[model samples]
Target chain A: MAAVKLLNCFVSPFGNRVRIALAKKGVEYEETAENMVTKGPLLLSSNPVHAKVPVLLVDGKAVCESLVILEFIDEAFAGTGAQLLPADAYARANARFWAAYVDAKMPECAGKIWKVPKGAPAVEEGKKEMVGVFKTLEGELGEKPYFGGEALGYADVALVTFTPWFLTYERLAGFSIAEECPKLTAWAARCVGENECVAKSLPDAEAVYQFVGGMRKHFGLE
Target chain B: MAAVKLLNCFVSPFGNRVRIALAKKGVEYEETAENMVTKGPLLLSSNPVHAKVPVLLVDGKAVCESLVILEFIDEAFAGTGAQLLPADAYARANARFWAAYVDAKMPECAGKIWKVPKGAPAVEEGKKEMVGVFKTLEGELGEKPYFGGEALGYADVALVTFTPWFLTYERLAGFSIAEECPKLTAWAARCVGENECVAKSLPDAEAVYQFVGGMRKHFGLE
Candidate 1:
């Protein structure tokens, strides 16, 4: 068997995603957590294009990008514990579409959600944008228990990691996600509460919010 | 056999990418050219999430996003023609990584590579960023005849469409891409010069430059 390893940051949503993917697939691998503040040589060398984690190494062949890594896990471990993506071609495309959405919208929303210093940009626009994105997601998730129908598949796996940031996402954006997207909120709760892999893989949302708060203060935003 | 159709814009790099992928795959499809400025109802209804062109309809099932469309073509039309993606798992992941890079970087670079009035954001930073992106790409290309090693594949399809905008990319950025990255420039020339699919699909660079000049004038950027 090829030795599998993961280079990651404990708090990174992308990194945690790789964790959830591997845990969900029941792929056993060694973990090397990097200091995201000053990314180590291995992470930098492994992913020179982006120079960010999480990177998965299968027998030291590095694969970067969370979405790419997720696809890699599905392909590399074809007959593992569970298949992450759906079997139907159209459903796979739909899954890819939402996965792309999560990557594109989540980070920018998270970055803009922080309370910044005066003279810095106002957060209202960011808040409004986040609300719109969530609503769109809600519309897509309409009446389905999960984005992948009945199972927590690729689309679900792609997004569920963001629950740890939902508190910060809502608080800094000055809105309640549940009020705007109750089904999505409930879906999020269910993913973390009902799914053991997601539950164990995700960090606490409150802790993440507090950590971000401290960073804001350190940068003199508070 | 499923009916295939492509919704596209003549000058869009992404739209052209879908065209190239299909041509390379030898998959015959009818085309509906959309007015990019006033996108029609079909485009809107087909891709509500993005509402962009290059939506491939295989038997009326809409698949949006150029990369997603490309993958759909490879899977849905497997064994019909040349496979655009490599057979190897790692190679497929690498192709996807660069495809993502082209999508993430090219549009921003092209948008910022326009001559704008003062107090409008400066173009220098965008130019520098584009140069860096090009250099990274050049290094990746190395001595390969194409990004796919010997043929025009996914990564090639992803980026080669940008050639029509190359003159404009160089013109506004105030750097000759040929001078900055000769191998990449030569590779670009070779792809369009040698590949029938790429050659027929791409618009003329000089004409695109002149058309963009008219648009700039319309926007009163002069």
Candidate 2:
């Protein structure tokens, strides 16, 4: 068997998706931590366009983008572990829909809170936007145990990866994902707590907050 | 075999993608063209969130999003036509990377031209932004015959889908994709002229320009 290797760092929601997927699939792989700050050569060469981490290097080949990696893993390891998606077409498409939604809309919304600069106009705007997204997510969650309504499918994987970040943002930004979105928040907590892969994969919430807090400075926020 | 049905509108580049894929694959299917100006139950039910067209209803199950539809079709058909993606993992990732880039980045560039108001401020700003993106694309294209190089691949499909709109913009907006981006414009022409599927999939260029001219009234550009 060609040895599997993952180029990632600690607590990357994007990377965590792959990490948890690997663990769930029972695929043993070596994890190489790449510093996201400087974004060393290997990371650059692997993903020239995005230059981001959580790159899955199978043998020597690298795959970029979290969602793409998720799909690749599911297809490549079809028989390995719990299927990441449904065998039915509509179910799979629905999962992909939510996954795309999480990647495109929700993450950007949640990202605003993390990027809020003290006293900046964007801060207030970001807060407003975050709440709006949270409400939408809450409405979507409604009373479902998971996004797919029973199984921890791709939608759950996408949403779960962000929960750690959301927890950190709720505290560091002095806002509340749970206060405004109790069901969604509760669901997130439940998902994380129930899954050993998730619980063990995430770092302490404060560490994530501080890590992102430094990122704000690097991006020249405020 | 599950019956294939497509819900689309004439002008959406997204819809065109599915059309081209179907034509290339020699897969015959029933198509329902929706008038996007007026809402339809089929469109509404198929894609409630975006309520957009290019929804591929495979055996009555809706698969929204052009790229996702393409993937579904590729997987569903399996053995027919030119493969939309490469078989090798890294190569497939690169193709998907470019596809995502076109969907994400190219649109803002194309939108600058397509959505440009007739007035000077909007036109100038649009031209500047459009040219900026063109420059990036041109540099990326370098000396390649297509975005994915010699053989037409996913990136080519992406660029070709939107070329009709660019052609219209060049004529109506008093700008030229060719002048700003010789390589990209040449590539676009090559794609449309070279591939019978691409050519057949697009409405006449002048017809699209006339259509754009009509849209001015709706957008208040008139």
Candidate 3:
């Protein structure tokens, strides 16, 4: 077996995605938490392009980009552990599509909630857009136990990482995600309850709230 | 075999990525050329989320996003036609990484060149940045016949689609891609020359120049 090492940052939803995937796959690997503010040589050398975290090192070969790393893990560990992607081609495409959606929409919406002043217009507009994004995701989820129907799969791994931030978002933005998108909120809870990997890997809600609060204060938004 | 249909716009480099992949795979497919200005029901219905072009409809299922659609074609036709992705997992990841680099960097850089006035400071900065992007890609290419070394693989399919636009970009931006990155230019020419799929799929350079010129005029930048 090739030795696996994950270089990550503790609070990043992106890094947490890799952790959730690795845990779900039952892969035992060493992890190095990096100081993202003052990035180390390993993080810089591993991902020179983006210089972001959740880089998976397999036999000293680095895979950057969380989504790309997820796909790589699925491919590299085919037939072992749980399958992150579906076997059918169309289903796989659908999963990839929604994962891409989560990647594109989440940061912008989440940033507005945390990075802007409490009463800023950007926050107001972003809250509305974030609700719409959740509604669309709810529709995609439909009545499935998971985005992968019965299994916690690619899209699940992509999204469930964000659930911990919902508390921080709601408190900061002064909106209730549970009220607006009940189905998605329930789905998120189900993901946490159903998978120990997800539960163990997600950061504590209060801690995340404090972290975001500190960030907001540091940026002079609070 | 399932009936394949491609919803595309003639001049979009994204749509061209799909065209190159389908052609490389030798997949017989119906093509629907859409007027992007007034999108049709087919494109809208197939891809409600993005409503963008290069939606590959296979047996009535739509796959949106060019890179995702490329992977779909490779997996769906695993043993037939040309292999779009490298067989080795690491190699495939590397190809995907650079293909993603092109996708990420191309639009912003290319937009700067053609969208702004020729002598604007933004254009000058953009030209320097574009040169850097190509230089990094040139480093990735090294001496490989293709980005995939000996084969026209995923990265090649993603990138060669842009070769036709080099002419339009050069003419509008008033810079020489050949001078900045000679090897990548040579590789682009080699891609068009060596592959029937690439040759047949790409639009004529002069036609692209005319289309871009028309777009610039319409946008009042001409």
Candidate 4:
């Protein structure tokens, strides 16, 4: 019943997070795709601090940062649907820790994959680090089927969006994420296959691959 | 009552956040200084992911990451003392955004002060960006006496610890933060002056200056 609107760029993993969170909560709202390069007024007004995508506007109130918005959705719509985070305090803290790790580690590794030219030696190093990043997550995943442990919870929501980027990174760096991190690869597949929210919210991996190629060209990296 | 132990380096702002948060909650805990460089076995085992400092051990369960620790402390000891975050969901989300800003923006800006040689032109650019960072916070602070409105809240706890580093940055960069952002200066002073926990938790500024100088020399950055 609350008016919920999201300002986002669809191809963004960060934007995918908000979509996944809202969908999990069964919150219906409007979403606008903001041009990230050209300054958009709505995004500027909503998130004056970062001016970044995935700004959730609830009845005109704005929540920025995908992780914060996930927490917001969980808290604001307390009774809505499945909670992204765990109910136990310690478990919630653990989930937050891994989610923070995903944010801290992912972008740098993901960027290196595309930032380097296809045949460059740097691409090899980038692939090594990218695989390392996934290996870390795979180690964390352990015997648990999901990062949330039997549920598609906070960290699952946090990380699954970026699986779409795996195609882009793998192709650019000439490495196979599925081969490097089989368990994590399987887990990602399970998230997309099992969770309608995750499946629907995430952009197609092929689309992400095309976008990354275009972006590298646009930024003169290509 | 849970058994709480903190593994941290004294000068780290991240460590200070945990100390302040614990003190705010009236929680009694053991403090062990961890060598961030050598990284003791306790820290390694406690935080295998990052192997970084400021890991909170509650009943021997390791909670890594300062911000996550802060949230854990708030939730784990619900009835102990003042809540770090606001009760309202919107306000809580806002607090998280600014805290994340402090984490994302501060280290990079603060690093430029010490990471560069004192006389380098990079210091001037760093100084400008450092001032810009403060101004953004000043703008966010607006007419409020505290970021939490009435008292030392989450964002306040998140940022106040970094004030000790300001002295070193200003000394190295030759720019006065007080002049650049008077309101934030006043607010920082108020936090240190008013909050006994903050006053005791933060390392002395002069000590930080010496540490930075020594570190620069050790790293061959001078």
Best by lDDT: 4
Off by over 4 Å in 3: B116-121
Indicate the residue-level lDDT of B122 in model 3: 75
Candidate 3 C-alpha lDDT tens digits along B1-222:
789999997788889888888887778999999966688999999999988998999889899998999889889988778788877888888988888888888888888888886566777777788889889988888888889988888888888887788888787667899999999999998988899888888899888888888877877886
lDDT of 2 by residue, A1-222 (tens): 558888887868788889888887888899888876788788898877678888888877888888888888887877889888887766777787778777777667666666666555655566677777667666666778887677677888887877777766666456777787788878888877788776777677777878887888888874
| Winning candidate number (DockQ) | 4
Report lDDT per candidate.
0.85, 0.77, 0.87, 0.89
**Prediction RMSDs, each to the true structure:** 1.8, 3.3, 1.7, 1.3
Candidate 2, residues B1-222, lDDT tens digits: the string is 668889987778889999888888888889898866887898998887679988888778789888888777777776888877777656677677778777776667556666766654656666677777667667768898877677677767866777777766676457777877888878888887788878889877777777877877788766
* Residue B191 in candidate 3, Cα distance off native in Å: 0.9
Backbone N/Cα/C clashes per model = 0, 0, 0, 0
Interface RMSD, in order shown:
0.7, 2.1, 0.9, 0.6
lDDT of 1 at B44: 95
State in Å the error of residue A19, model 2: 2.0
Residue pairs clashing in model 1 are none
Flag regions of model 4 displaced more than 4 Å: A116-121
Q: True interface contacts reproduced by each model, as a fraction?
A: 0.76, 0.29, 0.65, 0.94
